[model samples]
Target: MFAARRFVLAARSAASIGSKRAVHKGIEGTPPMRYMSVAERIAVYGLITVSFLSYPTYLMINLDNIRPKGENSLGDNALAEKERRAAVRA
Candidate 1:
């Protein structure tokens, strides 16, 4: 209860005091936003295209690593059949 009263008094005292600094005169002192130039636009577009296409490009590059070690081709079911036959023979 004492702490709460002290906190309220502090807040009231703080609220009564005014800041020494004045408020900012917004935008009047600053430059206005403008449209991008052709070169700037091209660079921005190029960056965006690179970011979006990078994942697919990386996946395409490392596609061979996605398959099983001996299965270089997608249709190489024969390799698995041979492995199974070898295991049975063993």
Candidate 2:
């Protein structure tokens, strides 16, 4: 009971304080809701693409450690096979 009341009070205080700050002048006295430039959008998309592309690279690196020596691929490898089984649902 006490914890719930305290949480409510804190949330109210935070909302009120945030609204007060929202009125303050942002960078160059401009609000942040403004749209980004075309160049900025392109850079942001490029960053996102790079970030996603690296994900497969990291997974490949970990899986590439033992491709020879008659060992199985990452899915069939003993270690990763256990993990794969755990992740898969019947």
Candidate 3:
């Protein structure tokens, strides 16, 4: 469900790289404008879907259940260690 929201928001957004770009050619030997086909669009979409699904797993592996572990046990405690470090640096 969360991923559905994320995908819709991302896919529908104008800022997405997959979205069409209206690049115009200049007269100084610039190449002609190129159009993307449905197959190309589908390939880009497939890439986005794979990336979105795999991102959480990558995070879990690196972030240890999406939270710090061992020497940095902030967890639900939230930024307590950060404040302590700032206090020390001050």
Candidate 4:
């Protein structure tokens, strides 16, 4: 019984990791945030501003959407993209 439980837990963790990897791959095809159009950036920033201002109260009310994506890969891509651009310019 204990071994079965451990197996299930390990399987669950592996599945979560797989999903995060899938999300990361999907993000890689997109242009980084800085390269996005002004309207897109403004919309993103507006939502971020509103989300920050709302804080815990908004999170509590909208638990589903507020949940973080597995690895939040966009931030990683932003830095990577910046470095790539700088390297090209140099």
Error of 2 at 57 (Å): 2.8
Error of 2 at 33 (Å): 7.8
What value of lDDT does candidate 1 attain over all alpha carbons?
0.76
Error of 4 at 66 (Å): 50
RMSD of each candidate relative to the true structure = 9.4, 16.6, 23.7, 28.3
Candidate 2 residue-wise lDDT at 3: 100
Which predicted model would earn the best TM-score? Answer: 1
lDDT of each: 0.76, 0.81, 0.71, 0.86
Deviating ranges (above 4 Å) for candidate 3: 1-34, 60-90
Better of 2 and 4 by TM-score: 2
Candidate 3 all-Cα RMSD: 23.7
Determine which window of 10 residues in candidate 4 has minimal summed lDDT: 22-31
Output the TM-score of candidate 1: 0.38
Of the two candidates 2 and 4, the one with more favorable lDDT, higher being better, is 4
**What is candidate 3's lDDT per residue for 44-63, written digit by digit as tens?**
88999999989777876888
Model 2 spans with C-alpha error above 4 angstroms: 1-25, 28-35, 66-90
Candidate 4: tens digits of C-alpha lDDT, residues 20-74: 7788665666769947999999999999988888877876889978777686556
In candidate 3, residue 3 scores what lDDT?
95
For candidate 2, lDDT tens digit of each residue in 1-64? 9999999999999999999888875776674335788888888889999999998988788885
Error of 2 at 62 (Å): 5.6
* Model 1 misplacement above 4 A: 1-33, 70-90
